[model samples]
Target chain A: MTSSAAATIALTDVAARRGNTTIWDQGSFDIPQPSITAVIGPNGSGKSTLLHLLLGLLEPYSGTVEVFGSEPREASEQLGFVPQSYHVPGSDYLTVLEYVRLGKIGNQFFWRSPKGMDQQVADAIEAVGLAGYERRRLRHLSGGEQQRAAIAQSLMNQPKTLLMDEPFASLDVRHQQRLAELIHGLRMDHSIGSLVVVHDLNPILPYLDGVIYLLDGHAHYAPTSEAVDEDLLTHLYGCPVQVTRTAQGDIFTRVTGHAP
Target chain B: MIELPTVTVQENWLEILTADFMRQAFIGGIITAVAAGAIGYFVILRQQAFASHALAHIGFPGATAAILLGIPITLGMVTFTVVGAIAMALTGNRLNDRDIATGTILAFATGLGLLFSNIASTAAANVQNVLFGNLLATTTSQLISFAVFLFLICLTIAICYRPLLFTSISPEVARARGLHTGRLNLIFLVTLALTITMAVQVVGVLLVFALIVTPPATALLLTARSLPALFLSIGIGTFAVIGGLVLSALFNLPPTFFIVSITTLLWVIATITRPQNA
Candidate 1:
């Protein structure tokens, strides 16, 4: 048996409830070490809920979640998070530089904010392709640029693992490429393990290493290279689907009745 | 009649500065400005202004109760306000939309205020100081107390400002970063309770409203940059307060009315130049 210590996320029967209604129930997953995984499903399949559980933002009624071999809060020091509204409040009034500085503020909760935190801030902003827009107010930036500022905020602390929920929604094709490029570089440069929840699977097929196909309480796990084939995809999707693979290994999942 | 140096600040400025009442009014108004602007900024960010208003009204009953018992009223006011804040914080999911709770507590507190005032040696209408305001009557000792308390409150805000801002903007993100957002919220509310109690004593309830809302609201419009926004609001607030106090002295009217009117006018001019989006 392999040593289980290196696994990043291991959840055992995590359940979430809102008042009387249950949002997610008794779900479990083993997220691989040092890799990018997409937790994908149709709408309301608890993708975001699973991420919250991993981040320790939500508690389970009857389960344990070990993120990086510790409780979510303990593991959070090495964890970075981005949500759907990444450009949420507190960014509107702040310059791109000041917005990223907030990410470093968390480091001061246990220790004083170091004098050199500005260098870390600059490095994070540079990593997100926002070197010149450093002093721009977040409101002055386009949606894509604002998102890059948010990415800079998440990357400011140099977290070992990053959990992003829908970081690419509502962006044009150009910005999407820029974001993908940013992700690619961060992975190469820092080897930062990332789990991003995305609605459109096609745009992201180029970046994913593994996929978690969720249907109600059940889940199917597969490597992007192997399980993303024509037969395997249709079964997990509960639809007649076909995967048209280009000779260069690009994947496109088209519904059976639809013309490609 | 003695020719004091024919000076730089327009023509009528020296006469206003020479008046003793004008000086007192100016100092009092400035103190009121700093207190109100600082508290109101948090009130808007936390969306707790209505709760603050309710606490002000709720203080009336507690103050009246204390007066009837021949004791200091600030104790009852602070106690009830803290209770209300703690209750609101701990309710969890049931009271997610805060307005409903604020309204309910407001109605209850006002009714109690009315009841307590009614049973006094005087009637409900006679306690105008509690319902409206009476800033003109603030004594020197009261002013000194205000300065000390204001310094302490601002110091506390300075120490915890970032986390407070984080929690105010997005509690989920704050929680993820391992901040005790709920506890921090209670601590802030407690400080707010202390502040409202002190302000209620000087400005009265109605004037307290002007102090808490107008300066910060005007500041939010005048400046887009964060640090500059705060400084601009304080500066704008100082100008309004000083001018209002001068006018209050010359015209013999309530300082609160003058303060609000001038600040509101400033806000109007700002809105004309600074559009909705920016």
Candidate 2:
């Protein structure tokens, strides 16, 4: 694990509320650079809310949140966000290539078109393993392919810190593995610190370096090895959980009183 | 000064182009079509179709109010719709409750239009022209205003194209990327209000919605790329205007019926031959 001195995202005494309900209070955590941190929580445990706080889309009711030791809003250039529910528009007039070009809109001026924008877009798409799919409209792509295009859009910005909300949801096993490998490669090569929200932890288990378990509006920070244990998960879930290691290096967990 | 072309009178469709009023209407229609088609792409992209429809209806009261106050109808329409656009922008930012806010604003605007039209007895008698339009009666000054508004629409699109697309496609990511979405939204609303006001003269209050929505939507079926779709939308709009005007001149029918009919017909053709199940 990287030292806390290399933290890319740091939150201290941060409090946030959505409408009448409080999401998190006095939430503090530091996400180290060049690492993968899996954020796991139940339905109402403020997983999505934390991403909003980091992105400055929602203001914290109190305390401070920082990205790269600066305010999140100030450091927006270095940050990338992949929302959980991104779909191609029904009247999709945008090709995948054009959609990804919008990624650089933030960093560039309205006038003075940047040089080699096409090459940059191509490289980003290729990095996400979507090279030939550039000309296709988003509506023509499959769900997994659409997700890849979304990732390519984010990757085009070359962000130092990537925040993915439910990156593995609804993905088949092969696509999920492909995404995991791609993300792992990004972390290794670019040294990008990524915080991924996941409902099922098995797909990302092999790639995770750290874990943040959110329970009752507060985060329980732990290393991957310590956080994935049966006892810790059982207590956190407020129910019996059976965790067993399989031959294929997978730690499968079954919550008791739930179907197999 | 440029020499104006003199045409030989003939019993053909081109004969209608000889009349000065017909020429003015044609120019006004072309200008209005280009503006509506260009701006309509963003409207469909952002899913603000209902809000845009509401904005058009909001101009009705402005027209009636202008007639009652003895001011230029275009001036009142611009003032009222701009104000209505601002109100909608403020109240419609909340995702879940925007439809309600838009509905309330639309109903209120319609009510004010009826009340103001009734108060101005002379204008009330000509209210059909305000609601259904009289394209052949367009004046030079009205055409100039359309030109100015069209220029402004183009300028805004040129400056805000990238960020606007970013915001429309993904508001949260755009915000995270440090875009001033609120400011962009306001600028778009103002531009839309101005464009809608210009459109009202050619197509009237009730029928302007067709031009703003149909062309761009039809273009969506033709192309999967934005630039092509934009150009196609403008092309379709221009064609519909020209076609509708010629047909109206020939059949002695209301231009609104022809304009809306041709636009909807183009959309139908597009839908039938669409590449995907759009």
Candidate 3:
């Protein structure tokens, strides 16, 4: 575990609530820099709530939430976000290039396009393996391609850390693997860490360096290897879970069945 | 039986074009069309068609109040619509809340309009003109006012274009990017109110959708690019206005009727023939 001083994200006794209902509390964790971490929890487990706290979309009910030792809002420029779903009305007509260019929008004058904006947009798109697809309308792309386009848009901010909420949702296994590989590549090539909220962790399990799991109204953090224990996961999900290892030493977990 | 004008082109085309009323109608119609088309692009993109429709009704009371007070109807309409828009914007970004706020305000404005119209029976007779519009009757001052309103709309849109687009498309991301989304919402709604005010002059409250919604809807069906779609929307709106006016001159019919018909027809055609992917 990285010390708090070197952590990219640090939460101390953080408690989150929606209205009067507490989602989670007493959450303390330090996510090391340049690592891919999975945020796994059952439905309504407040996995998304945790991400919102980090993005400053929601305030902690108590305690403190910090990104890079500052309030999330203060360090927003260094962060990028991908929502669970992105659907813009009339965006069916928006080209990939136009959509990606939106990431560079800051508190700037409307008339001034950023200098070297075209090259920056192109570079971001290429980084997400969406080269030659810039001119295509968003509606024409497949689901996986659209997902990549979304990642490209976030990369336009040149963010040091990315917060993706359910990036793997609705994607097929092949696409999920591709996205997981992309996430890993970002850590390796750009030293960008990601905290991804996900339901199924199998596709991403092999690539994750750490895990933040929400269970029984509390968050627990551990290295991926330690977090993949069958008994711990069974307790985390309240179901029978099976952890397996491939010959290549990759680890994955599957929920075996519900408790009888 | 009402006499219908002969379909034959009896008047010289140049003579009709040179007439003062015709010139004013052309200029005023084109200006209103441009503003509507530009603002309508974002309106459609933001899925605020209901809010746009509600603002027109909300302006009715303002127009009636102006008539009773012996002020310019445009002033009253602008005053009420702008106020209504700000209220709606303050209701937060939730579509459900906005619709409820808009409907409640629309209901109150309609009641106010009725009360004002009944109090001034003579001026109440002009309410029909406000509802249906009388483009050919536009005075020089009204034309100039339309020009001014158009300028304001253009300036606001120019200044707020990028943020407005960003917020409308992906508000969460925009907020995360440090945009003042609430402020942008206020600016957008006010600009929408201004556009609706100008459009009400050409098409009136009842048929305002012709200028403000149909052209942009059709433009969206044709292209996915912002600039091209915007220009196409303006072009289509301009064509509908001018064509309706020309047709009205030929038939001695109401230009509003022709304008609505032309726009509706174009929307139908575009919808049926749109690309498979679109």
Off by over 4 Å in 2: A1-7, A17-22, A59-63, A88-91, A106-111, A258-260, B1-16, B276-278
Q: Report the C-alpha lDDT of model 3 over B69-185, residue by residue, as the tens digit.
A: 999988999999999889888875688887887888788888888899889899745788788887887778888888898898889878887787778777778888888889888
Q: Which ranges in model 3 have alpha carbons more than 4 Å from their true place?
A: A1-7, B1-16, B268-278
Q: For each candidate, give the TM-score of chain B.
A: 0.81, 0.92, 0.94
> Every model's DockQ, to 2 decimals?
0.30, 0.46, 0.58
Q: Which candidate's TM-score is highest?
A: 3
A1-260, model 1: which lDDT tens digit per residue?
Answer: 34546556777776666566676665676776667777777777778877777777777666788887888877876778887877654456666876788776842433367788889998898888899987677778988888777777777766877888888789877777777767767877878878878766676678778887675665555688875777666655667788888999787777786323
Error of 2 at A18 (Å): 4.6
* Number of clashing pairs per prediction, in order: 0, 0, 1
Docking class of predicted structure 3: medium
For candidate 2, lDDT tens digit of each residue in A1-260?
34456466788888788998888686877767768988888888888888888888788888888887777777777777888876636325578888888887643446666788788899889888888988888877889888877777887677887889998999999999998898898888767768899987878888888888887777667888888888877766777787888898877677766422
Q: For each candidate, give its TM-score against the true structure.
A: 0.83, 0.90, 0.92
Arranged by lDDT, best first:
3, 2, 1
Pairs of colliding residues, candidate 1:
none
| Candidate 3 local lDDT, A166-209, one digit each (tens) | 99889888888999999999989888889999887898887888
Which has the higher TM-score value, candidate number 1 or candidate number 3?
3
Chain B TM-score, structure 1: 0.81
